[model samples]
Target: MIHKREFLRRNLPYDGRIKLASYYNSRHVRVPVKAAQITKAVRWHASLLQPVTGIDPAQLSARSLRAGGAMALLAGQCDTNTIKLLCRWHSDAMMRYLHQQSLPIFQRLSSKMFNNGSYTFLPEDWVPAAAE
Candidate 1:
């Protein structure tokens, strides 16, 4: 994807303003994608994928691609700083983009927390069963 963007940047004539996400218009001129065009494309593709993916076309938008990329990087164990740089996030605001932190991460954290604190949430009136 980066290589494709770079190839478009170097090859396309855009008066020194290269757009990473662009398409050739019907007139054969490459132009930057507008917001509406991106939304339309996302919806169109989602509709096509709905049968196999079972994803609602209405649930996807241009922003879904950004969040999905960030989630993919997080799931791959990429460092937060690298994700921030790649996502062009200026601050810790990038954390908000990671809304769906997976259950495994939470489970790992919970185990670590309980072990470090020497604590458990068992009921006070409960007792261990006899070995049988």
Candidate 2:
């Protein structure tokens, strides 16, 4: 990805302006892209990935990227406030996106549950001395 960006930077005539998404027009000149175009491109790529991923192309769109990022942050144990800010979510709606936890994470958590060791308080026969 870095190499592709470098190639674009070197080949395009952006006049020192940096833009991640752009394309050459019919006149062979580079033009800035619109949000819709970017969304379409993302969905197109998702469609190409369907065969290998077994995910329906219609189930994914550019919005999936944002949702995926939120899920990743949740899995990383990021605070809700930070995730909300990063995802630009104004409300607690981001909570809904956190419903799923990866199986590996659950397995690790379950393993740690009993491996942390066990302890008990003083027995019934034990008594504390009075503080004179």
Candidate 3:
């Protein structure tokens, strides 16, 4: 969801070819990066290395952040459907990870549901308040 202005700002000018030809003739143009590099670049930009915070970039890794995100999602009551969509996981690996992480919450929810007399709740009585 990058804005067009941001894209233009970050990218080489559309007229770069004319400028490059005048400046550096006979030089090979760099090949376009693969999708993996693009993903990595975006991830790195969004990582824990903030200039204001002065956090050491060496202390952060994509894998650690990914694991932390998964754990946070589990704690935040995000469902498997949401996780699958967010993480782009097509296999059962995410399910296994979520199951492992969410075992305690699942157990508690199951116990609560079972202990209740019925799973269904009674409809709330609705009354329209007088207009102010």
Candidate 4:
């Protein structure tokens, strides 16, 4: 999930020698990247995160970084509208990532709705279930 600026940076080391098309393939060759190779690259990146997160690499893809980054920005208190644009979402599609927040909101609302904080609607109504 290289952003536009980061994609440019990947070419910085090579300078003038390798132009726009250079990154299309691995270091040993100069052929255009194929789907299989790209998938391997994503898998490799996902694999590196497994040791730190205890998450299965098989469950992650390069898109995981984008989704994680969006959630991170939200957790950091960045504006939802800003995150939406940074993620290149033309619509409110980025709001989908904030789906985790929905649980907390629902719990809070349900708690108040069901007799002023005595929430029988959900067992763990006070605590956010998404964090678990």
Candidate 5:
């Protein structure tokens, strides 16, 4: 994935100005993308995810990327404040990401549950203490 990201960055045509996204249309015109363009790009790229993840491409939208990113941060055990800042979410809205956790979170909890010894104790009858 790191290599693919690097390759994409290297292969992409970069103008003198550094933009978040730059792409060439079939007409060979460079489109310097803005926020709205990124949404379109994300939706188009989501189609590519179907083949890689076997998910219904139609069901995935640009917003999925934000959710997935947030979930990734949650799985990483990043601080709640950091996640909120990174995600630009206000209030405790980011906590919703914890509601439907990813597999990594479940696996981590499961590992801890198994690795940590369980506590078991039987209570004995209480007896009066004698004066020392």
Candidate 6:
């Protein structure tokens, strides 16, 4: 994402190039990231996490973890296309889960009434009286 943004910025023929580092340095006293450091940092963070007891960390790819996270979000009622784009999945399984979970909530809310038999409204209670 950052690379794409930077590529667009640099490729545009402006009087001055908007280098990402300069943009960051201008905004903050300490620059948080440089494009060159992104890969190493991503790999280092991925390496630092311990794998599940039965799973090997080396065998796990970031893409797979992202897809699993997207699935979990769908199961929890997140918008499917948004999660799909975030996870970069090609299938509609996430959308199906979201719709299935949401249908029950919609049905329950639709069946409920604003007032039951125990409540009644009188016209006097709502209308203002005229003075003679």
Which one wins on lDDT? 1
lDDT of 3: 0.59
Please list all clashing residue pairs in model 3, or write none if there are none: none
TM-score of each: 0.62, 0.54, 0.42, 0.47, 0.52, 0.31
Give model 6's TM-score versus the native structure.
0.31
Q: 72-105, model 5: which lDDT tens digit per residue?
A: 8887788778988988898887666566766667
Q: Report the candidate with higher lDDT, 1 versus 3.
A: 1
lDDT of 5: 0.68
lDDT of 2: 0.72
- The C-alpha local distance difference test score for the whole of candidate 1 amounts to 0.76
Ranking by TM-score: 1, 2, 5, 4, 3, 6
List the RMSD of every prediction in angstroms: 8.5, 7.6, 13.8, 11.6, 9.0, 13.7
**Model 2: per-residue Cα lDDT over 70-118, one tens digit each:** 9898789787799999989999887676666455656777768867566
Model 5 / residue 17 / CA error / Å: 16
lDDT score, candidate 1, position 100: 55
**Deviating ranges (above 4 Å) for candidate 2:** 1-35, 101-107, 110-132
**lDDT per residue (tens digit) for residues 1-105 in model 6:** 453555466584343434444433443333545443644554556666644344444455544445457667755666767788876668875554455446665
User: In model 4, what are the clashing residue pairs, if there are any?
Assistant: none
Better of 1 and 2 by TM-score: 1
Q: Per-residue lDDT tens digits of candidate 1, residues 59-126?
A: 88888788789888888888889988998888987677685555666677788877967865567666
Worst 10 residues of 3 by lDDT: 16-25
Which runs of model 3 end up more than 4 angstroms from their true locations? 1-7, 10-61, 116-132
Per-residue lDDT for 5-67 in model 4, tens only?
A: 444655544334434433433343446445556567777876888788777767766566667
lDDT for each residue of candidate 3 in 23-65, tens digit (9 for 90 to 100): 2123433344444554576457646456766655444454545
Model 5 TM-score is: 0.52
